[model samples]
Target: MASELPLPLLALLFLVILPPLCSSWRPADDDDASVSRSVFPMDGDVAWVVQVSDLHISAYSPERSADLELLGTALRAIRPHLLLVTGDITDAKNQQRTTSRQDEYEWVTYKKTIDAIVGRGGIDKSRIFDIRGNHDMYGVPYRGGKLDFFSTFSVNSQLKRLSTITSILLQGDRSYQFLGIDDTMSVGIRFPANLFGHPTDKRIEAVNSELQYLTNHSNAPVTKVVFGHFPMSFTASSEKGQRYESVFTRQSISAYLCGHLHAKVSKQLWRYHEMRTTEGHKSSFWEWELGDWKDSRLMRILAIDGGAVSFIDHTLNQALQTSILITYPTDSRSMNMLESEKWSMRNDINVLVFSHQVIRSVSARVFDSYSGFKVVEEIPLQLVFSSSADRPLFHAKWNAENYRSPSPTRYWLQVFVLDSHGVKISSEQRPFSVEGKMAIPTRSWLSYLVFEVQWEDMYRVLMWSNMAFTILLLFTPKILYHFVSRSSSYQRWVMSVLTSPIQQRKSYLWLVWFLMEGTRSKPFWSCLVIYVLWLIEMPWFWGRATSEDGEIAQMYLSGWSMPFHDGGLTGNKLSNPDVLVITLPFLYLVVIPVIVLIYGLFAEKAIVCSRRSRRVEYSAGSANTLAESARLLPDAPRALLMKFSGKMVSMVIQFWGSWTRRALLLACSITAAIHLKLCSKLMSAYGMVPVALSPPLTWMPLLLLGAAAYCTKLHGD
Candidate 1:
């Protein structure tokens, strides 16, 4: 029995660390996300394209939909070669309910906005393409809005739609070829119910069939981009998507564009070094997710010039008539910019950066990749390669050679630009591989040793596993003793322990209480101890962590927020540390009493089972469900289960339920307010809702507390 518990307890402990293990590593910002280099086309025909997604049009707000119209009107003047809408054109989520899956009004609003995105600007409707998002499916928790999404675009006859289009400019050359995927799924009332990627096998086959056709067509556009609603990580989590990516690696694609995670952009780049059969080899594409227009008003401008692809983030100014085209380092995206500090002093690495707004200041920051990303040198880029009176060009030279390294140093150049308008923006993480005493990677595209897993990372995992198993191993003996020890034997043991007649009766009774009920009662005090521990741990965790955890990182609404890693939830989720704090108090509140009730109900069965092993045969009528003693449940475990469940339920109702109706209502109202506040924080962090809205709502819990106290004083009936 003791052996039995170690395995289960070890399993339980394993569950404890699983959150951080499988978690999606979320970077706080673009600078934090840039450990790897951006992948680009080495050579290709030039084309300028604009990609936007996750409209989430609210029917209640025409001004919200008007922003999309304003962007379309402005883009017509810029005349980008292609315009693409990835997914979630409609906001199906009910306005008030966090638990709501979708509704119809948002769908109708999206239908109108889609029209606005492709209005009369010489932008053809054929050039625009869209696919279904998880919100479009709206199949989680509620199924009423499943068909509502299709009404926005009535072209689809089947549930799933697939489309491939190639656009050509005046010269009749292949501009850009786009492949659209309808990858959507739904379940119910689960964290992963809607967010977990579940691609059907048939859909995978159809997508593969299309890719095969593109593979055969040599005249196909060299710049290939696949537009899907879900991010690559989400898709790969599915069985169908795994098969699709496997086939996709063989097919040379420039980029995989997606936009389910709005208000944020994530880029993941990887290189294939396999010497496998295929005409196309040695190419990589970065999956770029654009922010949402509904709240963020952000769009992406992808420019393909011959052999290079550069992306610029554009913010739509609703107050102004035209869109604001933001600019940064555009020239150095393709070249071997990764140079050693030794080489930098010998030969200057020229960086060309231009912005639409008036210049303020520019500085170059060099980060050491080897030494835990320590800033080896920070130099203000004073050497202006060129100056402009009307438009300011930002340029800076760093003394890279001054900080030369013996080993190949992994460093990156980040240019911070301040505009005259007091707006500051950072350049994309330009991670450079400096050649040094250590061998440098020569591959044109940056590569990291993924297969050569970092032993440190593995060791950390194993260390946690061992620690958990050992901690649980410590508790196995007690659990076994509790399961086996009988009341009479326990009493005898207590009497034997009281051999010291000098011991007072009060001390004896206290000892008995400590022995029997300490485990149950200590949890109450443990909660208080945890609060103090959190105070100690907060600073330690802050200094120790590279970034805060999960949705909390994006929205630190409270001074008392605990970090929980994501990826445990389920899209990139549409998903702890204050986990022990959040969990322990509830376990004390709910589990201890439930456990005691179960033990009381099953004590009879335990004694009966123990007696069975001691040569005592249970008679058919003696132990039968119909004739067992009334002191115990006369039936099986089901009867005991029901009796204990009733006891636990009755205790809660009899005790806590004694509160007046107003107090009960106030408690429920406060709890509901807290739940909505937490949900809004996550939704805003995920870019589903406006970040501005989250701040006002973050104060809801505090307001509710004040209101509760006031109501209590008023003594409302």
Candidate 2:
């Protein structure tokens, strides 16, 4: 049955969806009303730098037209000396076309956009520098007609040459270096070359050469700035999962600017900062991933005068300033006083709160909600010590009695610190879940027996079933053929012969059939058994495998971990199996035809042997026997049985091949699922999965269902 939605609810949904569009519709006003502009006073020769990426321009259209117009107007007014347009300048659709008509219409449009900005007079041509992106390799083809676009443009003499992935640019007396890297879109941290048809080593070497060039040529001290299409760092993901820093540290790079990620809102900017101190230099890398020009596009203005660089964010008519603040710990105190030094049931946890401002009187309270507005007991504390530091760190401890309440439930500790004037300085809160320990269970020899029995029993049952099916597939045809080949008289005679001791002793026919069946099933079953054992022994096999310290094992197992690890598997590890899967399927198909040829040869041999035996018998005056043999030799039933048997054998072989392939695939999927499950469990066990952030484990069953679907697809195909 269909249900209708209420009008009010439908209207509410529509209203909720309309605000984003309405906000986007209104263009940015030429004012600093929403932001503080006074903080950034422009006095020096500093101009805002706006990095544009993945423009993907084409001959004037709705999206590109608007983007070009807005960017052109904004750039003309700002006039930043160092404007870096990073990658994807042109969208190359087809690679097989001729050079002149090589479908660079997008690049042509991009050029026109640039021309519109700096004008046909070429006044601003020197200010705009372009780095090669992935799409630039469309002209050159590699193996199987795949294009190596980055190399093509990178080496192109008409285009600018920096380093392979890093280049240095010197502006006036102040030097600024730019490092342009290949894409880092992969599961590992190191930059991969296949995405751009270049080797990571070669790309890195190119960057190194550029650094060498800068070192040899430049005489003045330089503030290095790296430029790339991909962000060097990312959050909510692993560090070894992407290239977070420059490959080399020869140059003193201050900031890294990238443009792959588009900004959604005007005021929001993603800023990641890291500090590094070494023998020669102490520096910080500020990664500024510029927003897409189409949406929330803002330029960065850097003013350098008297050996100092100040970064400012600006639109066409307004600008904003940013600053860095640090906080640290001051002193430690307890909320509730305890009689003894150590509590019997629980341990006390000290809360250290670091803030940017000065703090005075502090209060510790037990709270109902996470915010701690409704306090259970407000414990006051005097300031034992104070410090004037960029990062002011403070501490408070929670005693066991403070958490002991009549409610018999989980509670949270909230600590608030105020300044001398009683204004709220800093606050910190943490939730604690309470649970009672249970008695440990006793273990005996029966437990070990039960565990072993379950696995062994299952293994034996599956193995026996597999062997039985294999034997039935092999010998059922031979038995039927033997019965059908003999006439009624011959059958009776054979039965009489079988009763004779000498004849029964010479009956090696059954032994031959047994050998043939064994030959067919043994190899297949052995392989299957080995694979099953491997599946069962997965944990032990992986437990002994070692990777670099702090390196995620799943990444290495899945063939996506960094090559920098001491014992990590590399790209070659993945390529070998991928090649085998692609090439072996055809080899298996060829083997089927060879098997058919062998079967035909055996059938011909049997025919020849029977004819030779009958000829000898006829020559020896056994004419009656020969005539009877001839009459019975047509073997209509045996021929039909043989045909049926061949068909069944073929079907069994096909099914076995399909099932084996499917089993391999299923094993892979199961391994992945187990890895993911273990990772989830580890996160939960370590309390890294926050209570507020963690979702229910309800999706686990769905994942299992999806794995089943994948297995079905593997077998069905």
Candidate 3:
């Protein structure tokens, strides 16, 4: 086969495969290694920042008021150097989660609560940073308009723009640089239609410019951190087709902190982005997604000890007694090695404890993982510093040079805290390495899910994958039917696998045949009609129209509006594939086809079961044996061939008759109903009418579902 290939074809193959194999990659150099800085200190050199996100304060929810008060209490207790609220400062939705509307009272409440907290806690307004999430941009026409409540009331609004760069210099000349990015859409379309982070080309270039300026002027060992509202996966590309990850990797960001998806989405979303730049230097960073503060009352404490960074997410409450965070000798499994070398060079193990009660005792417990994590040594730590407002610091001298090894070895460490009342609280035992190595085997399996997935790359994959899958689903059956009569080995093999009684014994093969058979049913055609009609226009909803230059003419948007196209009623130009365009098509066109196909399967099953009493069915095992024997001996008899065909029909009928399959069909219908309702609400937010209720904004899905169900029953009868 290789010898027969054309020269151009061979050359093209090598062109596609050679570059990645030939490239050399190495990790980007750390700032600490290049710059001369003071040796790691015991105290004062370390600083902590507090991050609280998705507060969603509103008049409808009373608990949010208490959450704000609890935050103030916690801030007074910990007294972090800086505070970061990473967007969705106000819940932009009504009491019902279905509609999206911006309320100024909500922003006013947020502003007042934050002002009270700042007054009570003595936190400088300049040290606090806030950015916008999707909820923050609902139904706004432009950036600084009267409806842009974020511009009027947000913390960063005091400085003119929400996106900002702020630097803090700790004792010993150690600097921490924080970059806040605002990637909310310019038009601020209504939600849940505006579900992605959209940054203009200028915004991306501005970020690049700011980071470049900081890198050029800064001489001290700086710990760079970026804060934003959206995770990399949820953010869309800029108009210039640039992503934030490229800037983060090039700038050597320590971590990108965010919170949009709360606890239910995933308990913890930790992504490690390792990239090789075009210049052949490898760089990496961590994207840490914290839980929401609305319901969970979550807050994150991020500490920078020397140049190393570590963080802990904790729930805030009125009665919480003690919270502990080990700053020095960071966790082996989670720390980014490229960020700092201080972890291996530090001579002391330091822990910060925030408590209301007087801390009477502090100790460090070490365990040997090779010996079944048995307790090996317990070092008594002393209270190094205690402030009336800030958290107390405890330290113990230890020689990191003594624990160096040829390869990585895990050493589990835990800190125990005892108050004056004899209440003991301990930190979770986390593995660490003196060699600054990773504990690969002990890491969570979910961490691998986040490895090496870039923002722009994932966006393209989602866009192309949806298009490819939809086209294949619609065209495959037609193509297969046309070629079924040809003498093709591949087709013959596939048909044999789909039809053979022995092969049909496998559940997955039967499922494949069931879906394949369903495309020929009447319900599938009914669904395809609606789906094709949806594709013809792709109209979502109607709303106020705005131009590219922030011009809002009371000219209302009408007719079919394609979000993907530059020419539209909305007057917004969007060329790249975003979550908004990609996800909406998938929910409407892609999902309905799948639901109808499943209903077709159940309808066919119903017809099969009605005729069960008329004909006797054969056992799959016995029938398969006879069928195989007849195929091997083709000249044996015609009666044997007829019996084989009948056996196949009976086997297929049995495949559809299982109680498990029936239950699954019913479950799929219920799931489809729920999915349809969700899509309906999303569409209605954009001006599309619903199926049942007056105003036509909330009932269309239920009506369509009823029609599908009625058609299924008619086909069955």
Candidate 4:
């Protein structure tokens, strides 16, 4: 059967297709320059660079139209000498089936977008370069039937295809050169495979080959630049592989630029960036992990004038800007100081000094503040160098004059190096001491005691309780099943007890009515008097006194001597104890009292049911003797015995469940406690003690209370 498409669906598709076509046909403007501007000076020979990545573009849609307009406007305004579209220009293509109409449309739209970009006259088409990002190679094949999709769009011969592994050389007349490499995304490699199909070793070889080829072919000194879509090093992959360093070493590349990581630029980006740059060649290397255009939408502009490169970063929304300048030093040197040099007391302390021209030809001063007094007197120092160029690596030796005997306390050595440029780089304070006296102990015993107490009292209790509770909750049903299977009589008893109230409802109602009459006969004032008397007598048999205060006092006193005099039993009386003793006894006593009260209220109802049954049995006139009545009465006892058995079985199952629950709960509580205790200890050891109050210990108590309440509710139901 053939299905016909709905007209409304077709209309909807038509509406979606109309806007893009209209946008594409709209006349192109060559002079629009309102969007972005170059920061480089007008007369200077500048290198205008544009970076684009993660395009994810498909066909000419409304989204693509807006993007194209912005990009076109920027190109006209900046009039960049070169543009680099780093990677991920399109989504992955489906390779298993024949190319579909959608794929063809997407490919055409992609070509159109590129054409529009290149068509802008401000950017030199020859200088435009594209690097294969992960998405560019989609639909390519791998080992074991896996498809490498990024390679599909990346290798198209119709467009000016660029290699995934490549470099460019910038020189006069021959302003730009492009080197292309393969895609790193392929099979039989490690998890974080190379962007190019080749392994890192092979890639390095290729890069070296390309660099050597360019160096040999160029007529002038070429400014070398390399581009990729991933940063050489970052937090996530800092320890993963060696591709970053390997590629770096293979070529004397000026700057390595990449963009996979969307690192937040504000917090510690500068420090990490500075650390990654080569030490002596710091100005020669630069990296930029361009942020996403949709969210952060940041871009970088690199302007080169002769040997100087200036980088400016900007947000897509024009909300923020930052700039940095890079220049190679015309002359530089290295210096090393001998640590074995010793100071002498005979020479005036002022005679010791070191100097360097690059470090700015300024006098040096050294001071040793070992105690309250200055150990070394003021010293004047001079620098001697073989030549001006050699001054950068000059070193000086200093011997402290009139240096007295070592002080018994630790001291700090402060060195101040001042330059003619007014730049002062200070070394971290160095600590030294004269033959040592005992050092003052910074840790206190009280802190240790508190930590130990918390671990034992709070942490252990909570961990154990949690473990016990979890186990009990998991195995409760099985325990119940086992109890029920043990005795048929118990099962019968439970069924009878559950059904008894339903069978004798009418009798229960009459008995309740009789009790109301009896209560009504009593005077209200007399009844109140009797209640007061009962309350006055209840405490004598039910109440128990708590001694927690005495136990607490005892615990506090046992570890240290007290100012007040303490005597045998008096000391015990002053200590605190657990309050559970008094509370538990009172709770147990109240249970019996409640049971007695209930029995009294229901006694009349039971008697009425019995009399009714006896009358009916007599009317039947078969075996109506006392022996039969006795036999019938025994049935009640037998039923009760079966019910008792059922209850016993239930209690046994409940006990196991409850014990397991308590054990689990206790274990979890202990684990949590230990974690907290360790944290506190670590914090204290590092001198992070609170200046005010301490952490509250109420959580454990609250947890236990909640668990008890939950268990009580479950058991009662």
**Which candidate comes out best when scored by TM-score?**
3
Clashes of each: 7, 19, 6, 65
Off by over 4 Å in 1: 1-44, 99-105, 139-146, 151-175, 186-192, 219-221, 239-245, 264-283, 319-479, 482-717
Compared with the true structure, the alpha-carbon lDDT of candidate 4 equals 0.35
The 10 consecutive residues of candidate 1 with the worst lDDT sum are 29-38
Best by the lDDT measure: 3
Model 1 lDDT tens row, 1-717: 344345445444554554443223221111111111111221223455677777776655566677777666656654565676776766655455333344566666666665665674446554555656656654332222344445335222121233322222311244345566655542222111244234445555555555565456656445456667776545533322244455455555555677776653322222222223356444344456677776778777675533234566666765323222212222223322222332222223333234445566666677776788777666565434323231122334545455555544356556676667888777665554333222323432222332223322343344345434433332433353466454557655544443335554567554443334322223322332232222222221111011112232221101122244332212221211112222233223322332233222223222223333322232333344323444464457656665565465445433432343344445445555554554443442233343324333233334433443343332111
Residue 30, candidate 3: Cα error in Å is 32
lDDT of each: 0.43, 0.37, 0.62, 0.35
Candidate 1 residue-wise lDDT at 639: 67
| Tens-place lDDT digits, model 2, residues 1-717 | 012113223433443353321111111111111110001112222223456666645333336534565556544434444566776565443232111112345554565567676663123565566665544532222211223333333222224443334343545545555555543322111111112112243344455555556567767655456667654422111112212344344343555666644554223333423344356443334455565544444554443322223343434222221111111110111111121222143333332222223455566666665344467666654432433121122333445554543332245555666655555643444343322211112334543332213321232344334334433433443344444434567444434433356545555654443233322323332332332222222211111011112233221111221234333233221211111211122222222222222232233233333434444554455444444555655778645654564465446545644554455445445544554454343333212323113222223223433443342332224
Query: Over the stretch 1-717, how does candidate 3's per-residue lDDT look in tens digits?
Result: 233224323333443353321011111111111111111212356788899998888779968865677777777778787798988888877777766677888988888888888987677776677888878877666567777899899877765444333333344457676777766666566554465666555666666676676578767677788888888877766544678888888888888998888765654677777787778788888888888988888889998877778888888766456889998788776764643434446678989898878899999988877789898778888877544335477899987776565445557889999999999999999877666776544335443443234444554455445544554554454244334424467445544654467634677655554544555453444445345334322333233322222222221111112233232224434212333343545444535445544545444554455445433433455556666767766565846676767777767666665544455457556755665565566544543332223212223334444455554442333
lDDT rank order: 3, 1, 2, 4
Ranking by TM-score: 3, 1, 4, 2
Model 1 error, position 107 (Å)? 3.5
- Please give, for residues 1-717, the per-residue lDDT of candidate 4 as tens digits: 012123223433443353321112111111211111111122222344667655655543336423654565555555555677666555432332211112344545566666676675345455566655544443222311223223333323333342335455444533333333433333211111112222233454556666666668767544455666644432111112224443443344445455544433331121112223344333223444465443445566555434333344455553221122111110011000011132112221111111222344333333455445354533333443432221122223444223323442234344455666676654333332212111222334542332112221232244334323322322232234344435677445433443367656566444433333222212321222232222212221110011111111111100111122222112111101111122122222322222222222233233334434444554445323433545656777756655565466456545644554455446445545553553343222212232012222213223332333343233222
Task: Locate the minimum summed-lDDT window of 10 residues in model 4.
Answer: 329-338
